[model samples]
Target: MADIVNLRMARKARARKLKEAEAEANRARFGRPKAERLKMERELERAARIHEGHRRETPGEEA
Candidate 1:
């Protein structure tokens, strides 16, 4: 029981470390700021708006 508990803790710790590393890498690459986030959101929304009319639905599938 003690070994199993220890193993679980070790696995959780490793996963947490990996997540933190990934977040840091993402921040470094993308440089998250409020302005940038808003800009990205607006760009995505514009793309969706532009493509809305171009989507073709499959037969028998109700969108």
Candidate 2:
């Protein structure tokens, strides 16, 4: 015979587990330090500026 389980406790436990999983996911997603994120953003912006600087304009393609 299977042991009886309390439904309320089981439900609460499951909710706790799901909440923990979401928190873990959020930590991984947004875990970068502010300085590191800012540095990355600056590097990306510099790269974009360089890329745009190197672009050649076609005479007939003006929009």
Candidate 3:
């Protein structure tokens, strides 16, 4: 004979597992160190500056 299980407890446990899995996935997708994020931002800013420097026509000036 199979052992009896509490339905409510089983349901709660399942929900907890699903939630934990989603949290793990979110962490992997978006978790980054502060220093790494800052470095990425700096690199993007530098690239943008270089791009703007190469442009002959400014946005406000008429050719």
Candidate 4:
């Protein structure tokens, strides 16, 4: 005896496969990944400055 499968389940499976295929294609075209980007280092330096500016507490200020 053969087991019957639901129709809706098959449609959902097809949609998920198509989305995965598109993501793979995009990765190949972009070439260098996020780790290799020069901008990453520059952004890190900029963030450090902003946080340091906020952390300074003035003398005699109320707790």
Candidate 5:
């Protein structure tokens, strides 16, 4: 004889798995600390400013 599975139990198990996956995704998307994020933003801005400073202006280009 073959073994039988409960339909309700299987459905509940699937729902639990989906919920866990959603939670994991949410954590990954919002896991960084606010200070760390702000520091990264500041670093990017500083690098951009430095790059612009190093750019050479052409004689024909208008300021």
Candidate 6:
């Protein structure tokens, strides 16, 4: 025979789990300082620019 489960408890558990996951994600996204975020964004842009500078031009075409 299979075990019987309480549907109300199961539903509350699922909701709680979802809320916790959302809170964790929010913490990661909003926990950083503004200056640190700006620094990271600038670094990423600089790296992208450096990468773009290293690309090769195709034959008979301008880069």
- Distance from true position, residue 52, model 2, in Å? 20
Question: How well does candidate 2 match the true structure in TM-score terms?
Answer: 0.53
Kindly state the number of residue pairs that clash in model 6.
Answer: 0
For model 2, residues 1-63, the per-residue Cα lDDT tens digits are 999999999999999999999999999668989988889889999998898788798457887
The C-alpha local distance difference test score for the whole of candidate 6 amounts to: 0.91
- Reference-based TM-score of each model: 0.44, 0.53, 0.54, 0.42, 0.51, 0.63
Model 5 misses residue 9 by how many Å?
0.5
Candidate 3 C-alpha error for residue 15, in Å = 16
Of 4 and 6, which scores higher on lDDT? 6
In order, candidate lDDTs are 0.85, 0.91, 0.94, 0.79, 0.90, 0.91
Best by lDDT: 3
Pairing residues by index, what is the TM-score of model 6?
0.63
What is the lDDT, from 0 to 100, of the residue 36 in candidate 6? 90
**TM-score of candidate 4 versus the correct structure, residues matched by position:** 0.42
Q: What tens-digit string does per-residue lDDT give for candidate 4 at 22-48?
A: 888877656667776567668988998
User: Mind giving the per-residue lDDT tens digits that candidate 1 earns over 3-29?
Assistant: 446878889999999999999999876
Query: Which model is ahead, 2 or 4, in terms of TM-score?
Result: 2
Model 6 clashing residue pairs (backbone): none
Candidate 5: tens digits of C-alpha lDDT, residues 28-51: 667889988788889999998898
Runs of candidate 6 with Cα error greater than 4 angstroms are: 47-63
Query: Candidate 3: TM-score?
Result: 0.54
Kindly give the stretch of ten consecutive residues in candidate 1 with the minimal lDDT sum: 1-10
